[model samples]
Target chain A: MAFPDRFDGLPAAPRCEGVYKVTGDTRGNNVAIDVLGVTKVFGAADSGFRALDKVSASIRQNEFFTLLGPSGCGKTTLLRLIAGFEFPTEGRILLDGEDIAALPPFRRPVNTVFQSYALFPHLTVAKNISFGLEMLGWPATKIASTVERMLALVKMEPMADRLTDQISGGQQQRVALARALAPNPRVLLLDEPLSALDFKLRKEMQIELKRLQGETGITFVFVTHDQEEALTMSDRIAVMSAGRILQVGSPREIYDRPTERFVADFIGETNFLEGEAKVAGDRLLEVRLDAGATVKATAPDAALHAGRTTVAVRPEHADLVPGDGPADLTGVLKNIVYFGTDTHFHMTLDNGVPFIVRQQNTPGEGSGFSIGEQVGVRLHADAAQALKD
Target chain B: MQPHEVEQAAIRRGTMRRWLLSAPALVIIFLASFGPLFVMLAFSVLEKGDYGGVKPWTFSFDGWANVFFQHDIFTGELGFADAHLSIFWRSVRLSIITTALTLVLGFPTAYFIATRPRKTREIWVFLVTIPFWTNLLIRTFAMQEVIRNEGVINTVAMRLGMISEPIQIMYTDWAVLFGMTYVYLPLMVLPLYASMEKLDFRLVEAAYDLYANRFKVLRRIILPLTKPGIIAGSILVFIPSLGAYVTPRVLGGGKNMMLGNLIGLQFGKGNNWPLGAAISITLMVVVMVALLVYVRATARAGGDDRGR
Candidate 1:
């Protein structure tokens, strides 16, 4: 079948019949890792787990890329394949236009900061940073200078002589980063390096990691299960589920305009309103909610038809108005939740669906509406996204 | 009573309770160990009686002197002799050889078993312990059947035309060494496997990612991490082989007597009870020295690990 014109670097559709394509500029024209049609299966032929199926993507040079998914979603498998700890059962992994699928991990010019930190307890911090350089048969003087430079980069000069177990968790993390980046590999892979740190430390390390990437200008392929971390640090995010890439886009594009229901729900909270979609005009569409309310929205392409679809709306996008104003839907205010920065108005729609509207608490914005009072909810034209069921 | 006095009395009562609870085990160990040790110490310095006994009333240093010197019984003059010294050195050599061989054989076996998948790992470990189900004497006797002049190995080798005549493998120090290694191999493997199982294999992947090949990874990562197990297993094998009696008697054919056999003869046919006790004391001292060295080395390693 002839598919629609997809945006550049968009993955293949889930089904073979057709695809609803998004239009945007292509990303990462200069590729670092070309994972073409990779399929990996673990264990025997009769009984095995299919960790990845026909997974393919291009990681661009000097980009902070993330493979974001839940646990057991093949994100780590893909990372290991690129790191050469694992090989694809089928297809190829190319590094700089060379097929490195058959290469051993020692021969691959890539390093990984393991999730557990995997620091050698027997070695000091300086020795850990110098291991890769020494493995390359570098001279002792060169190794010493490189280790010194890495210690300075990670701001760990004081703890260089300390054993790995003697340092704190955050220090170990910096040491791991310095070790992985010491050899100046063409690409670096990190497997949830911040998961072991505390909340404040994680936040600090996120900015530090981004700065390190920018300073070194090395391509980074990071794997994480945390959506917030991916959104905060990554240049681009590939949302994956059930061994398939659901969507790949910038953080703003993913958060503001998610095309998949999984992506919409996984990245942030959204309301799935059941509706029937119909094309109203060029680049304009309407979804009739089950409660006989028509919501207008804009479609990325002309794939909207007169059929059943789901309208996704972020909780913060809905506005609260007076009970007598012109609104799309009316509900009884059930409760009011006071957050420090924002307030949520929880209500039950006339059609018996729970609706929540978040509003920022201005200085003088009083709790004007009491509980169990009637209220009107309004939606902007650009807020709703109609997705396939 | 005052509060402080009451607290002190309670502390004293708690200490008495704990000591009472552990008194039985402590007394048993003291009786089983120091009881015979005191008797042996007294026997070493006493005068030798005619009927293979120690004279209770007399004291002499002749027993210690007889270890490295010969005395003309009639003249009562002492001269240096190296016969007993040679026996002690032979025992040391055999122990070292047995420990080395077991270490070489056990490391690979333990590594192979530890690296297997979980289900198969249990089975391999079970197989390693299978030799313990039978008696050691029965097992050593069975080993004799394999290495004897008309044994299964000789017959097989003759049929394969590898040798025209049967090779003399039995009744030699080599046979004794082989028997000791076979008997003590499982002791070495168990500790090695225990330590190897606790190793984090992710460090190996990190090493590989850092450009270390297989040999470098093993040398730099696996071997050094498992050094504690190697030391423990070596001590287990070495101590037993040093004082081994049965294997040397049956396999060495009484041609090359180790310290155990020599000490046994001094008390049995040789009828020198004082000398026998003296030699036993000397062997215990040597073992104590070996243990002290190991303790010192491990303590240093521990101190270094603590960043001292």
Candidate 2:
């Protein structure tokens, strides 16, 4: 679109100047936001809840970074600290190499589209979009032009006169994004803005948000508990559990080679086989399961001569073979689940653990599996990884 | 009966039963309210009798005439006088003042209470309502004691040497205004509290995040959202204060009489029941007109909000 040319009239993105810079990975020149060892404790010192414990991450400029976790895992708390709604009990939050930990919400150059949208019920869509510009003391003409541009950006020009309550939930979400983006904040914090919508609208908005983020070239720090959303839209994802970041990497890295058991379990469905492992050779490890099945997989860590470890593999990677041929494992097929495009074979391993294998629904494939039928499950060594128990 | 006719009859019976359930309360309200009103309307056009009662089958416009015109005893003619008009004007002025004062005091108080933590909100609301349990007359008397010369306020002021002589506060216009404001303060606070409690506090945080200062947040967001409560509280305080009787009669010291006091005088010592009924009906009409105006304004406001 011709939108990028419109922002040329505005000044360049704000940069910190004339201040003594902290020399560390936390405050790099190319980084848009640097959260440095921030610990947030709620309640009193004697007996308090540490909502975020030494959480540190650096978001690159124009990156879609996600803090993904379940509820109460401090993802929203970390977002609030960045938005300046909550103060961290320890450490600093830097914006463009300048510390903004002491700044109020208004003083900081960041805006948040709240999970509830938080639209002013009394104002029209246009008025809500223009609010931040008006607060910044822009001229009426400037604010009007900016508001018009924003409404067009969100494709909400026709509903500009409608109050917030008069619009649907998805429309309100777009208006919130427009309102936050109108001010041209350096970073926009989204606190699960799509969690309120139905499945279809949420999918549409997910793609729209990615497009908007690409068009605006603003750093987005999105917080959500949905792992699929993080994997689909984010340049990098931080997997958090129990107030600590377990892993931070690109989606492919997080999904393919999760460093921790929690990250492997939380990101997607995985079948974890408990076994004893030892380094077989270069780039390979052999794990002997309790049911007398020996499997070879790639070791995630090189310094692993492990006594006890777990082999994690996705259900799609494990295949169901016809008979008791040369196989890595064998189980009894307990159930078959048809899921439109694929079928899942629920099996009980010889060790009495439930194992699932998913196969594509090919046109010529026969109904070769049934309840309580004996089957052999084979795992591709390249697709499986050995993880610390 | 035939089958279809029997079905129709059952439907009729169902409708009748529903109406029968609501008929009793509806009948009682109509009688209790319209009964006295019809009597008052009839009395307003009748002639005054010899013993503080209306004369039957005798009608005149003298009660309405007496409100705006003064009767000359010798010349047997009537002309305009400001006596009754001034009383009505004073009542309007006092009502407006009382409503304004209550709002000025109630808004901040209600906002404070509503902004409090959820655990302590009910306690503050209970404290606001504690005054309602006491008799209003006793409360007015207590106010009189506090504001009277040589009363609590004057005694304390004299001892503190802020003033050597006692202040002439009681039995004045200020005393009546004080009593009205004190009695009706809770009426204003309660409605304001109801709306403020339902206000979405997240909007306030959003406004702050958008760089709005506290005052702008209040002016643009809080005040506009809570306007319904303001209008409701104003009507609650204004209508009653317009026709308040005891406060003006006791604290006004008979020098500055309001419509309520004048209406009472016509029915009591003046022995003119027709004139009293006429004045009461006029005050009722004024209050009704005010309520209609408020409703129209709020409706238009709502329409404007949506139409835009």
Candidate 3:
């Protein structure tokens, strides 16, 4: 399926800078969380190492912002810091303009759905859903109605009386969501909420979570290591590595126009070609690859210097045709993998530079490219992105 | 080929291996433990000779009759009535006191130790269990020295002029309770620690998140979760305290003799094996009945909590 029309105006070719800010309709003027220069260290003073180093990001109210990174990238730690489970060794966190640095987890105006789903095993689904409401000292009548509403919202009303262990994992996840949402906190933090579910269930919950976010209008700060999940669910993703954010933008911007080599490799599969750049025109540039070949690409920013650099070209951008054409590289097909909807051909260039080309699986007989067959890998030079050294 | 045949073969193999491995220890346990109990039962019902040894196979209730009906020859104290009523009640009272004290003190200490960080918790648990490694008699003697006149406490009190005479702190009921609690404190703490360590702190956190204060958390979440440990610790402390002879014998002087001492007297110096056996049998029956009742009550309570 194609992307929704709402995302059509998004830059088709990755733009380098000035991505749109995500401010949900419900929270026009509110800044839900303003985390500044947050740093966290683990272990004791003599041996402790930094886990988050001067990390800073602002999540708008009612926006579903995701902290995306690979494992050990401090994304979860940053989320935990925002949730008040861990205090930052340095820096400040402001919720609605109040410093919540010294606040305990229970006192913070946020609730977390832990990655483990940490439901009280002894409590029933109804009791689990109503826990936060009871904590807020709501009347029994109000709590009952609220729990019933949340149960319906998460489509778990039928299993309300079942023990957490009695229900399926998906049902328990909904109960956890209900429990966290029942408090009606200003921000709801999820730590890899869907990582525990099967692929289909994860996809189903992704839609449910997005719909719930729209309905409730509560700001959500989701942490995930899955790049696809981050792309699918986040309004804006903060791509992080080695305790620092490399780039923060909408999913399209992060994917299409990554700011660094780490962001490019971390977000999706890309073929890196080391080259030198020279600005050719207002929006065009010439890159000389290390293999003594020159190619044309879009110059996204002035940071593209006239020195050795790397060019990141996504696999889908490279087209495999019948013969050599403009801005083309000749190669032999080493491997072809048919993945039901698309075919990927691993091609090695004449200079021994390896690259992949992916073609959509259309109806009728598609291109029958065989292994060890000679082919020309064509590239739309405009689709290639020039990166800073 | 058939399911029943396969099942039978597996069962036969399992039984053969189990018997081969356990036969020696099982025989030794039966001979060493149950043999004496059977002999005691038989001797309790047999007739006593004029010289006071058991008359083999001459079964009679004369020994039991003498125990229940006969008065003391020396002090005219009713042998059965006074010993059974006073000594039994004294032992029960002392055991109840020790068990309650152990529960009160051990619960907090166990909770603290269970909640410590991993490395520090290991050290604390080790310290709590260290006292149990010492000899029980040696521990009792150490307590004796601490509470005795001219011992460390009295020496200090005398030197400070807190009292003109060395306080009569030793050989009292308080001293007996103190010694019992000291010796059995580790037993109570260890079991309670085991249960409390398994307690998910998240439950307590959940309670607090549900607006439960610290005291409410203790009463509702902690107390109910650690009930098994409390029950087990109480039984451990109470059963041992009821049958304790040495601690009271040394610390209670001669004034506060418990049932164990009386049972010992009847069998040893008193030369009445049937009465001693009957008393011992009665004490065992009472303890067993108490244990059964406690277990039944706790099981019912646990069921009710789950129902809620």
Best by TM-score: 1
Give the poorly placed runs of model 3, Cα more than 4 Å off. A1-21, A24-28, A158-161, A278-306, B1-83, B108-126, B154-167, B196-223
Selected candidate, larger lDDT, 1 vs 2: 2
- Model 3 agreement with the true structure over A1-389: per-residue lDDT tens digits: 11111112333222112222454442334567888899899987447878899998888766789999989999988988887768999999988777998887767758888787877765678878877666666778878888888898999988887878899988888888888887676788998999999999999999999988877777889999999999998888999999999888889888877768888898888988877788877756788876556788665574455777788889998789764454367778899888998998898877889989889899898677778888887776565777654
TM-score per candidate, chains pooled: 0.91, 0.88, 0.83
Q: In DockQ terms, which candidate is top?
A: 1
Clashing residue pairs in candidate 1 (N, C-alpha, C atoms within 3 angstroms): none
Per-residue lDDT of model 2, residues A289-313, tens digit only? 8655788867756326667877788
Residue-level lDDT tens digits of model 2 in B2-22: 999999999999999999999
- lDDT (C-alpha) at residue A242 in model 1: 85
The whole-model lDDT of each prediction reads: 0.86, 0.87, 0.80
**Candidate 1 B-chain TM-score:** 0.91
Q: Residue A168 error for model 3, in Å?
A: 3.3
Better of 2 and 3 by TM-score: 2
> Model 3: clashing residue pairs?
none
Looking at model 3, residue A2 earns an lDDT score of 15
For model 3 chain A, where is the 10-residue window of minimal lDDT?
Answer: A1-10
